[model samples]
Target chain A: MEGEIRVGIGTDADLVIARAEGRAMAQRLGFRRPDPTLIATAISELARNLVMHVGHGEIIMRPIVEDRRSGVLVIVRDEGPGIADVGAALRLGHASRGGLGLGLPGARRLMDEFEIDSQPGKGTTVTMRKWRLRDDLERLREKRQQRG
Target chain B: MSVAILRKGEYFIASIQSDLSDTEVLALRDDLIERVGRFRALGIVVDVSALDVIDSFAARALRSIALAAKLRGARTVIVGIQPDVAVAIVQFRLNLDPLRTALDLDEALALLELRPERKPADGR
Candidate 1:
């Protein structure tokens, strides 16, 4: 909980580093197989976005606890030109550049919770969390009840 | 740094061993294109099973590589996308429809081998 991994994203290599760190952190937090992959994929998307748009950024991975739930939190911040229209940016197939245009929206769908803050010419910050412990416990209970 | 491009008869197989950077992806695209031409390969099978995470950049790169291979007279098949990566791809609507897909390398090879157009003019 106290140890947060911070990865700098400048080039494409940094994207891989960020994803590896994210996956490892998720696993350390007791996330299941798919959850760790999801977290890693989400981090990859965010880090790639920073490299493409801002040219440089940072991703922070930390563990979070709320009530009886535990999850991993990812925060990506960049000092690049911010999105002028957040809604349009989130729309599918909306790309100002040449990429697939699914970075932000895709990352949003992968994580349990997602939030973004940006100001034109200022910067952008994206925060996402995936809660696993509670969900896994709930799934186990469902399986046990079905066996009864 | 160099993605292996193995030659299996007239087919080219590229197995991604680790998470790739954007530059590496581009290099792969170029390498595959060059190999398809150099080997006169009829099909390309890209194995992504080892990659736990694929972002939009990599997805786009794969799509472009497939398209480029097609233009070079080679079919492309992406094999072994994990269930989680598949879910994220569909949820984000990353349009990789142009590239053919298979469950694994075996299926991909079988699909390529079975295609009538892929057979030699002598019917081998």
Candidate 2:
């Protein structure tokens, strides 16, 4: 399942859908327990940033596999007034528009890898991923079962 | 609309039925604060077990509800935080100070109950 699930983020209701989709994708990709919850929370924060700041955006989620590690990837993009200072925006307690300013920073902490690209007066795009490693025993069992 | 708010004696219990949008969260916060004043409630119990993800905005909104209720002479206790949701929130490191939480509805109600300090008997 390499297909990407895209959800348009416009209003508050859209945030709910994005979060649910993120969690569902993570679960389908075999993320266990708190990882799915963490993925959902991260999606919530990023999508809220779109609704609160840009008024509109899109979130893309996909399952990715690299070697023995599999994970979920999320990309949020918005074409509003871009962040001038990415560093300040990432800093906790820095509210640019009267928000709690926990969106980007909190999302970064929840995901294993996070990157942001933005140009002033252009737009912003955030890419994040959470990976789960396959245990040696599990891989060996799967291989033996496949051969049998 | 998914939230059910009921008056239990001197407290208002707002039980969330499902995942709520930001607007719904704000509406719940406003409704609880207003009910506390209109009914002269001594406390408010908000049940959030139905919510799978309590992000920064929702958490902040809950805190706002608690703070507003406190200002009106009422205490607020949140209940039924799912285990996975709790783990996610802790990792976010969101400052939830001054917001009381309980395991379930019973615990939340107990926490809201007024328990007077016991006095020692004096022998003459």
Best by DockQ: 2
- Alpha-carbon error at A30 in model 2, in Å? 0.3
User: For model 2, what is the alpha-carbon lDDT of residue A35?
Assistant: 96
What does candidate 1's lDDT look like per residue over A33-108, in tens digits? 6778888888888888888888999999888876467888899998889988999888777887755567888889
Q: Among all windows of ten consecutive residues in candidate 2 chain B, which has the lowest summed lDDT? A: B115-124
lDDT (10s digit) by residue, model 1, range B1-124: 6467789999999998887778888888999999899889999999998777777777888898888888899999999998988876776667786888999889999999876455667873
Query: Where does model 1 exceed 4 Å of error?
Result: A135-148, B116-124
Error of 1 at A56 (Å): 0.7
Number of residue pairs clashing in candidate 2, backbone atoms closer than 3 angstroms, sequence gap of 3 or more or interchain = 0
Candidate 2 ranges beyond 4 A from true positions = A137-148, B115-124
- lDDT per residue for candidate 2 within A2-82, as digits (tens), equals 589999999999999999999998888889999999999999999989998999999999888765888988999999989
Docking class of 2: medium
TM-score of 1: 0.87
